[model samples]
Target: MQEIVSLNNRISQVIDNIKKVMIGKENVIVLSLTALLAEGHVLIEDVPGVGKTMLVRSLAKSLDCDFTRIQFTPDLLPSDVTGVSIYNPKEMAFEFRQGPIFGNVVLADEINRTSPKTQSALLEGMEEKSITTDGKTTALKRPFFVMATQNPIEYEGTYPLPEAQLDRFLLKINMGYPTMEEELEMLARTSQNHPIDTLDSVMTIDELLRTQEEVKAVYIDETVQQYIVNLIRESRKHPSIYLGVSPRGSIALMKAAKAYAYIKGRDFVLPDDVKYLAPFVMAHRIILHSEATYEGLTQLQVIEALIEDTYIPIRKEL
Candidate 1:
């Protein structure tokens, strides 16, 4: 109980620090942190200039860890992202030079604007949490969270991310436009300077590592586990979905739920936790049929429909 309270307070502090700049998007902030705490990556897809980069920057600034940003373009090369071995004449040997990816928080700005080969560079780093090059493996630092952003409006020259790449993201967040009040506040806040410049680190790398470990220890009842499976199965059988959530999605959902519960100051998983996160975790993983797309049926809609039809388990008194 004491540990839970300590963690909850620390998380709240980080959220508060991020909120200083990210005004009125607590849900997005929480979701991003949830992905981080779950030891997974986040993919932010939205129209450009909706504080997408700001959100990533603020989160990176709030941590006492190395932050790097790679502005992916058509000319970006895999070696540019994962680094390459360079021959050093002075030592008569080749020395490996680390790329921008060797950081705690990496922001892949305009990720889709790059070629598929360049985008695939992140595949190994994101999933394995390490980069293998020249038949050598280099492990990333602890709490290696990726906040990759792509422009949804400009698909003209963008290469669509393959399914394998999409599945690696534990959550796909859309930072919608702010309300009128929020817009005004944002203007006033940034009139002089950006809030991120004044932001300081509220948490350390050690605390973050400990919290991530604790997230995995959050309890999940057996019935809740079954509930997650049921949702996954329902997605497979849904008419609108041509391809359903895979076991990876199931595992991602479970891990996200556990981390979310920990953030909520609870040590046990609840049915509502799974329901709240299912769409974000499972939607991007499913493939909608062409007919369904023509009919304007979205992945979120299909997942919501499935949630409505799936059974919810009740907990009995111990």
Candidate 2:
């Protein structure tokens, strides 16, 4: 219990530091951190110039670890995102050259703009935490995370991520436009220089790993586990959903809810925690019926409806 509280305090410190640069987006910031603590990748879908890159940059700066950014383009190849093997005559061997994917915090800016072949390059790293090249595999650094950003408004040149690729992410977040007051403050703060440029690292890699361990230690009641399963099962049978949440989605929700509970300074999971995160964790994994889309219905709305219909476990176990 004491350990959980200490970890929560440390996590709060990191979030507070990030807020210095990213203004008025506390929920987005929290979800990003939750995904990190859950040891999963994040996919941010939103319009451009709305701090998509800035949020990721701030997160990288707040961590005392090696950071790299890959500007994914249409011409980007698999070797470019991962690494390459070059034959060196002097050494009489093929030396492997590491790419930007080797960093602790990697920002894949405009990920969808790249080709599917290039996007597939990330699948191995995101899931296995290692890259295979030249018949040898190289593991990524500890606390490895991929913060991928995509522009939902622009699909002209972008390749929509396949179900398999999208399932690799633990959570998909959308950062909507800021309020008038928040934008005004943002303009004032950036009048001199960007805050991310001057941001400082608040936590070390070792500390982050310890917090992740604590997140794993968070307790989940049996009933809560059933609740999570029910939600996923309902998604499959739901009328609006053409493709339901997979087993991986069930695990992602359970893990994310544990992290959310940890963030709320609790050692045990709650029904409310699951409720709050269901839409975010399961939205992208679900494919709604065409008629539902035509009716202006969304996956999120369907998930919410399911939640309301599903029974919640009482808090006695906690």
lDDT of each: 0.93, 0.91
- For candidate 2, write residues 1-318 as lDDT tens digits: 998898788888889999998899999999999899999999999988899888888888887778899998989999998888899999999888899999988999999998888999999999999998877888988889999999883467888998889999999999999999999999999999988888899888888999899999999999899999989999999999999999999999999999999989999998889999998899999999999999999878888898899887655743
Where does candidate 1 clash, by residue pair?
none
lDDT leader = 1
Candidate 2 lDDT trough over 10 residues, lowest sum = 309-318
Residue-by-residue lDDT tens digits, candidate 1, 1-318 = 679779789999999999999999999999999999999999999987899999988898887878999999999999999999999999999999999999999999999999888999999999999999999999987889999999874467788899999999999989999999999999999999988989999999889999998898899998999999999998898889999999999999999999999999999999999999999999999999999999988888888888999999776889
lDDT of 1 at 192: 95
**Best model per TM-score:** 1
Name the Cα RMSD for model 2. Answer: 1.6
Report the Cα lDDT for residue 66, model 1. 88
